[model samples]
Target: MIIPAIDLIGGKVVRLFQGDYAQKTEYSASPQDRFDLYVSEGARYLHLVDLDGARDPAARQLETIASLIKNTPVPVEIGGGIRSRKDVEDLLNIGADRVVIGSCAVKNPTEVKEWFRDYGASHIVLALDINIDPVSGKRFIAVKGWQENSGVTIEDLIADYREAGLRYVLCTDISKDGTLKGTNVALYTDLHREFPDISFIASGGIGSLDDVRNTAQSGAFGVVLGRALLEGKFTVKEALECWPNA
Candidate 1:
């Protein structure tokens, strides 16, 4: 699947230079503009994240994002600041194809399961942001919109959520997101090979067309494009050239 990212912060759609909220660039005149740009690129699915929504679960840009979803031909999968069943319901009811559970999956594992039970695996996703501390031999999920660690390991998180009936998962390397540093392929490849049944998605550090090719070959069903796509590192059409059948 080919997906483009629409990361919203403070109600404005922006792209982080490297997950550095401060070094980001605003690319759209409006949310709808960004949506249209992606649609023009032949994208049929979008990865949406409300950066502000992640900081405060109450900071809802749902209506703004929902409005874009209605106008865009691509279906949307949203994350960032989803806390409750109501949050998930509101997004889905408003036109979100899938409601992503990020920090909440770590904060409330049982709730993640309940959501999957209620919405089914396809409509619910768990976004796991992995930050590896190599020297300490530790890995944790960066929570609160990648500002803090949730103290969860990638392996453990995937294992737990899969038991909760989660088949779709989005994984990002906080250190690499928006960096154009290339994707953390070894990690994703291992995870995908381990959980062969789940639809694993890689979501950061894709710099060039080869990155897109590597990601698809790594077994990630989809990869989200942001900086690279905007900077003309590769066209959505070019990325699709390397993507295997659907």
Candidate 2:
């Protein structure tokens, strides 16, 4: 599936470059307008991230999220600041098809395990944003909207959640995120080889139709297009056409 992203910052649609909050670029379009646009383009799924909620634990964008869900025909999966059972329940109650657990999952794996079992693997998705050491090339997880390093490796977290029955995992290379440089194909390909059972959603650094094709060829279950789609680099129709078998 080709998931169009609507990243929210202060109730406005925005995109951050390489996960740097200071380097954010806000679009003039409203969230509802973007939702309508994606729906019109034949998008089956939408990816919504709460930039505010990720940084503020007390943040709640339920009103905006609810409006998008009520207005759009396609299912939307939300992430950021979802830290508790209530957060998951509230999002689900408000019609979120799935909630991506990020910082909280990394902080407390045991509690997240219970959530996976309770909410069912399909309803709960894990967002693993990573930073690769420049020299050693070792990947480590980044949390709290990619503001802090968790010191946990992607491999370790995947191993921890493997038995939790997680069906979906969204992996984003923090360096490539919002850069439109291209996805880290080697990372995802290696992940697929190691955990072939889990459906991985490739996020970050998608610049054009060719990038989407490369991601699909690398065995990603789906791709999350943020800046590329918003910047008019490629139309959703074109992307979907490139991966007809996706």
Candidate 3:
């Protein structure tokens, strides 16, 4: 599915350049307003991220999340500041279709695995944000809202979750995110080949319809349109038409 992303910072819709908080640009429209627009344009899924919650799981933007959920008709998968079972339950109770676990997945695999088992893989997503070392060309996972490195390799985490029966994964290359450059198609292709059983959704650095086409051709389960969609690089309708099965 061509998932639309609504990133929340201070209860307002915003997009950060390369995951830098200081480099963010705020959109005047409310989250509800954007969600309504996307829904009208044939959006089947929404990728909602709580920036505040990501900085500190204790500071989840529940009110904002609730408002978006109440206003939109489509299924919403939420991420950021989701650390415990209660956090997951609260979101699911409030109508979140799926809860994304990031930092905690790396910090406490055992707890997260239990959550995956209890909640079922279909209701959970493993948000793996990573950055590739320029010189070495090795990928390392990032945590704490992509501010800190977890020292864990992306491959290792994927392997860790494979045993837990993880069904969905949202992989974002921090360097490519919000840049409007293009997606890392080669990376996603390799991932699809490595984990043929998992559904991998590509995020970050998508600037055009061609990027979306490339992802669909790369065997990705879906693609998250962020800056490209917000900047009018392409419309949600066009995206849907390009990948009807997305």
Name the top TM-score candidate: 2
In model 3, which range of ten residues has the least summed lDDT?
237-246
Per-prediction backbone clash count: 0, 0, 1
Please tell me which model should have the higher lDDT, number 1 or number 3. Answer: 3
At residue 201, give the lDDT of candidate 3. Answer: 94
Point out where model 1 deviates above 4 Å. Answer: 136-138
- Superposed Cα deviation of residue 55, candidate 1 (Å): 1.9
lDDT of 3 at 218: 83
Tell me how many residue pairs clash in candidate 2: 0
As for model 3, its CA RMSD to the true structure in angstroms is 1.3
Stretches off by above 4 angstroms in model 3 are none
Clashing pairs in 1: none
For model 2, state the Cα shift of residue 57 in Å.
3.4
Over 4 Å off in model 2, which ranges?
none
The superposed Cα distance between candidate 3 and the true structure at residue 210, in angstroms, equals 0.9
Q: Give candidate 2's TM-score.
A: 0.96
lDDT of each: 0.82, 0.89, 0.89
TM-score sort, best first:
2, 3, 1
Evaluation by TM-score, superior candidate among 2 and 3: 2
lDDT of 1 by residue, 110-223 (tens): 877988888888898888888889897566888766778877887888888777777888888887887798999887788888889888888889998888888888988898
